[model samples]
Target: MIRGVRGAITVENNIEAEILSATESLFKEMIKANKIKAVDVASVFLSVTDDINAAFPAKVIRMQEDWTYVPVMCMKEIAVPQALEKCIRIMMHWNTELRQDEIQHTYLEKAIQLRPDLTKQ
Candidate 1:
């Protein structure tokens, strides 16, 4: 079966370094919480709020040796009114036996408010 794991994080600023750092932290936490292997990831879709344009979160993740072979894409989040600012989000298409309900979703920093229901699961 294929499952999708989601994750999001907030960056304090729109700086490139901040975006990259927050993305790395968010990805690390998501991986740790779900116990997922890089080899199992089919592809990753990353998006950032309109306010964030200093860097592409997916590019930062692709720097990992294991991720070089993984397909990744970065896009701009729809600019909805009252949407979270400086937030980066990721959805990983994983080839795994885990059921959809068993997949762990992660939300870190201020982004936790985005999906409180999934944070603890």
Candidate 2:
């Protein structure tokens, strides 16, 4: 069965540089945790917090890596009060035989505190 994995990062600033750095780290950890390869991923959906209107994190992610043809989408995260700031989140649907418990989700930086249990799991 296929599985969906999620990951997130918190940017230090709204600037493109900070966003790129955080996103890069986030993607690395996410792919590592989930044992993902280009062939395993079906699609990735990325969303940035309202404060991060500078650049699309997903585009930066693709540019940083030579992903040639993987499908990635970007959007703005809902602006909820007291929500995480300058955050970039991703949901990747992958074709895998792993069970739900075997799927790994990464939440790094400030996002690490979002779900401590999952981070440890």
Candidate 3:
């Protein structure tokens, strides 16, 4: 089955280093929480707030040791009024046998407020 694991993190600035660091951290957490392997990932879709334009979050995934072949796409998130800023959201399509409810989602840094419920898990 194909399952989508969600994760999000907030970066301190639009600098490329900061964006890449935060994205790498978030990606690691998501992989650890869901016990995901790069080979099992079908694809990844990453979206960032309009304020973040220094770098593409997908670059972090490609840097992983065995993730070079994992399909990844990055785009700007919708500019919602009063929504969180400097946030990077990820939706990873994974091939797994786990049920929907068994999947784990990660929300970190200031992005924790986006899904308070899942953060507690």
Candidate 4:
């Protein structure tokens, strides 16, 4: 079966180092929470708010030792009115046996407000 693990984090600034660091942290947390393996990841899609243009989140994944072959894409999030800012969101498509409800999603920093229901208090 295939599953989608979602995660998001807010960057402190629109700088390359901050973006990459935040993305790496979010990706690590998501994979750790769900016990995901690099081989099982089909693809990853990252979306960042318009204010974030300093770097591409996919670069973080590509830098991982075992994630070289894993496909990754990055795009700009829709400019929704009143939406979150300086946010980086990721959707990882994984091949796993776990049921949809059993998958763990990660939300960190100010991005936690985006999905209060999924995030632990």
Candidate 5:
């Protein structure tokens, strides 16, 4: 059976390093929680809030992972009133045998507040 894992992280700053770090952490957490190998990921889609336009999160992931095979895309999220800023969200379509409840979703920093029920202890 295949499962999808969703994760998100917020960068406190718009700098390239900050964006990369937050994204890297989010990916690590997602992979760890879902027990997914890079090859198990069918595709990964990332969306950044309108405030983040300096760099593509997918490009950063490819560079950091040095994986030429996994597909990744980045897009801009709709800017709503009082929406969270500097946020990067990821939805990973994974080909795995894991059950639905076994799939772990990660929400970090400000993004955690967006889904307290999922992120809170």
Candidate 6:
């Protein structure tokens, strides 16, 4: 079976450092919550709001030696009126037996408001 863990975070600004830091932090937490090793990851898709163009989110993941071989892609999120800004979102596919509802989805910083239902805990 395959499962996916979703995560998103808002960066403090559009600078490369801030984007990389926030994205890396979100990836770490999502990976931890899913209890998945790099080898278990099939692929990762990351997208950021139009407001963010400072860096490639996948580049930050590749910086980790363990993820050197993991397949990753980064793209710009769809621009919608009043859409979340400085938001980086990732959906990681993992080969696991966990059911859909069993997986954990994480939203950090202002992105948390994007999924208020999940933040209840």
- Give me the candidate number with maximum TM-score: 4
Candidate number with the higher TM-score (2 or 3): 3
Clashing pairs in 2: none
lDDT by residue for model 4 (1-121), tens: 8889999999888999999999999999998898889999999999999999999889999999899999999998999999999999999999999988888899999999989999977
Q: Poorest 10 consecutive residues of model 1 by lDDT?
A: 56-65
What does candidate 6's lDDT look like per residue over 12-103, in tens digits? 78999999999999999987887889888889999999989988988989988689999999988989999888899999999998888788
Which pairs of residues collide in model 1?
Answer: none
Model 2 segments more than 4 A misplaced: 64-66
lDDT of 6: 0.89
State in Å the error of residue 88, model 2. 0.6
- TM per candidate comes to 0.95, 0.91, 0.97, 0.98, 0.91, 0.94
Clashing pairs in 3: none
What digit string (tens of lDDT, one per residue) describes model 2 on residues 1-121?
5688989889888888788888888888888877788777788899988788777788765774546577899988888999888789988888898898898899988888777888974
The ten-residue window of minimal lDDT in model 5 covers 59-68
By lDDT, the better pick of 2 and 3 is 3
Candidate 2 vs candidate 4, TM-score winner: 4
TM-score of 3: 0.97
| Backbone clash count for every predicted candidate, in the order shown | 0, 0, 0, 0, 0, 0
Q: Could you tell me how far off, in angstroms, the CA of residue 30 lies in candidate 4 after the best superposition?
A: 0.6
Instruction: Report the lDDT tens digits of candidate 5 across residue range 59-118.
Output: 766875545688889888888989988999999999987777767789998898887877
lDDT by residue for model 3 (3-78), tens: 9999999998899999999999999999988889999999999999999999998998998999999999998899
lDDT of 1 by residue, 1-121 (tens): 7789999999988999999999999898888888888899999999999999998888777898688999999998999999899899999998988888888899998999998988884
